[model samples]
Target: MRPVLIALPVLALAFLAGGLALTRPVTVPDTALAGLTGDAIAGEAVFWAAGCASCHAAEGATGAARLVLAGGQRFASEFGTFIAPNISMHPEQGIGAWSFADFVTAVQEGTSPEGRHYYPAFPYGAYRLAARQDLADLWAFWQTLPSADTPSAPHEIGFPFSIRRAVGAWNLLNLHDDFVVTGELTEAETRGRYLAEALAHCAECHTPRDALGGLDRRAWMAGAPNPSGSGTIPALTPDRLTWSEAEIAAYLNDGFTPDFDSAGGHMVSVIRNIAMLGDEDRLAIAAYLKALPPAGD
Candidate 1:
């Protein structure tokens, strides 16, 4: 993980001072999003699954919860700050008129329409496992949003990371798995897999990293430091018999611990998404967790 660009002291100061107005870049909508329907309820569930508000509209911002896809939120860490872009319906600023095909490609392949590449920061790797139907629903939901004219902010990075072409190399090395949810299936298992691997993207942040910032599968979801540097994200392993499968699942669904503890950090927002799931989903995820052995435990 290198910074995407080098900066002078004055330029860096201006970026920090202007907040996010330091960079502005755009290409025509490349992903085809025109297939999306106008349905709202199903789309709402998709919204929760994608965690759109986490970066696009932060929980820390005023009206963040209601801001939906209007971009301009900032996520900071040791890597540098990543400004979330507006995805509202606004044609000039946000993604108001994108087609469903565009949305699907962007979510599953991380390829922007007209062929621009999305940085791995978008978490499209985990999202690849998303079912087309669910993705379509999400597309439908985004279409109904209030279009906002808020603009995207530029990123501040240093060195090799600054080169947009470098991301292609990173993707070639790290993005080996295209989202596929095959193998064995019970309905519960499949659903659990989809949520854990795709939309929820649980392992994207919770799994520890290797030297180059790829996932350390050996420690998968065994609790890792938050990349955002906010706080420690809890391990989701089944290490202790005491934690129990049911307890974790329930906690995910409602944010309540067996001992009356509550979800915190990025999880507070995560819980809201999990809670939107049906009871069967919550239980299936619980079953999957209980079945796992903690990494290296």
Candidate 2:
């Protein structure tokens, strides 16, 4: 019993060390978006596309959380809990002192104000492809918003996971810091890619995971029980991969299926966001869906 008791901490430490050590580190690159200047109109579009109010809004806010962007929401999962941080221009806690470049890199590249890698949990992977002008404009818009003085609460992961430094390793294995990846340019394909790969950010909730906390590419967008331990979220692919693009598009746009049912779960909020986008952008997103690999499940 004495030996067992002595070995417990050693085994625990070893386990944590192994988990923490499987991290990935990356240097965020200056994206095509990094060099553009801010514009108000473009910023408003960016705000809508990124669903800026979703996380930053006060618990009850129905619209933008402009003044209330001092993060108050608590997101829980198996990994533990994360309290969204204040993002208003409050100097002490929020991004008040951050320059446009600072905010741009953070949004587009997953780098923090001074250039630390942000957890993909920030959802920058989708924001990565936002045009440079749009990113800059959003920064300008953020500057005009009223400031919040409240600081963000810290994450509640225990031990090595709580050692934010260990995130350096996680980034190396699972995170990709590059905000944009260039490819052959075509207006239609580019539009589709932008909506699916970036703005719509389809992969975040739909993608499944491995035991080590990395997404299983095998199940990319196949859907999983949201690990917060709510029951299974269900698959996006059509039942038996039978839903056509037109049906999926309709489901996304109206939240009602041709099968005479309605979309639910995480998709409810997603449909609402899509509803706000212009028809062109919405169609682009729909087009992208047709191109996604069918659920490998």
Candidate 3:
């Protein structure tokens, strides 16, 4: 019995070591963003598409103020409440010192500049599929945005979940770079897929999650309970949202439904950001939503 008890501790230590090795912070190559000239002008479109302002900007900020990226928004989830960090260009309080490689690593690999794993609330899982060139453009545009002195708020996670390194393991289970909508698609549909799956990260909110907090891809765009615990996010699937393609595009553009009801809640911000996109882009999103098979209740 003494020998068996001694071996149990050894086995536990071995298991922990293995887990650490498997979940080590893995970042992209340092040269991933090298040689790509950043275009701040072109990046404006990517900024809107990526919805960077939706979460990072000061809550209730409107119009031009949304570009500040002060990042005090709080997101409540089953695990805990996650706070958006300040990503402005402030030399002391924000990411002003982050290199282009740091930006790529954070967005594509979910690894922080300090080699720590970022919480999934940042939506790196969806941002991972973004085009490298577009990311470079975003970096340029980010530099052009106004800097802020706002300090980032810490997450409200508890216990073992507070350990940031543990997020490495979570990323292993949830981070997927593949396109959710596949098979042959029209040019517009393909663009829409990129916008939906990668830039806008629609599934991050629209899709349901499993027990471990990983997205349930099987359900796709079927709506889920808002992580904020308020109400269900409406499903984009044909089963629930039967809006015609034109209606969908118009709603996205004008933020008004055919019933003349105006957009409300977080969708108001989403519509504002998406409205910055070209008319064709809105139509493309409608096309992609129209093509989806019914999923989830």
Candidate 4:
């Protein structure tokens, strides 16, 4: 009994130590931002491509109001409800005081200035693929947006899921810094691949997950049971969609399918964001989708 009691305590300490090591925050190198100047005008395009307003803005806001970014939106998941944080330019209520390094760390490593792990709900896993230059531009453009005085609401997650340290283990399995869809490519296909896999994060919605909540890369964009627990997200692969490149581009630009059916559900906001990009960007995205191998092939 005495030996058993002694061993139990040792085991507990080892477990705790392991958890701490696994969840350690990753920091960006100071040199990452060196010699990089941000372009606010160009950053506006990155902002739209990243679809920041869709999640960070106040719920139900439209038009110019989407730019407010007060961040009261609630996302319900099996883990719990996550409230989007205020990312506006307010010093106290938002990220006004954050430096370029802080922003880059948050986007790429999912670590905050205080070294806390942001919930994966923010989709930093995909943002991890973003180029440093694009992030610099995004930071500059974000600075020009209106500041919101609204404070962020706390996430309503419980128990194990609420423990941010556990995210470190999750990251180990799923958080990759490399870009998806690598290979030799034309300029349009390359641009589209980056837009889809990095900035737009289309996979976040269109792909399914395993029981551990990590994306099932084997089934990439083959559609998923929507996280909202409603209708299915359609597969975008050539086998399922069969839309011509022009039709895909037109749908992205105008939200009308070849059959005149409009995009609905969460995709409506996605279309709106894509609409803010140039025609070439829309065409590029379409071209990339059309080039994808058929699902399961």
**Residue 181's C-alpha lDDT in candidate 1?**
33
**Candidate 4 local lDDT, 53-133, one digit each (tens):** 989987666788878888988887767899999999999999999999999999989999999889888889989888889
Model 1 scores worst on lDDT over the 10 consecutive residues at: 21-30
State the lDDT of candidate 1 residue by residue for 55-79, as single tens digits. Answer: 6774554343555667776666555
Tell me the tens digit of each residue's lDDT in model 2 across 68-172: 687877777555677778888789889889766667677765677654656556777567666666677878777778788887887765544454544454444
Top lDDT: which candidate number?
3
TM-score of 3: 0.92
Report the number of clashing residue pairs per model.
21, 11, 0, 0
Best by TM-score: 3
Which candidate order results from sorting by lDDT in descending order? 3, 4, 1, 2
Tell me how far candidate 1 lies from the true structure as C-alpha RMSD in angstroms: 7.4
Tens digit of per-residue lDDT, candidate 3, span 1-297: 243353443345435754669677777776755679989999999999999999999887889999999899998876678999999999788999988888899988888888988988888999999999999999999999999999999999865567666566667668886998889999998999999999999998899987667799889999989878677998999778998888999999999998999988888889989999999999999999877878844
After superposition, candidate 2 runs with Cα above 4 Å error: 1-35, 64-67, 114-117, 177-189, 238-247, 250-254, 259-263
TM-score sort, best first: 3, 4, 1, 2
RMSD of each: 7.4, 5.7, 5.2, 5.4
For candidate 4, list the clashing residue pairs, or say none. Answer: none
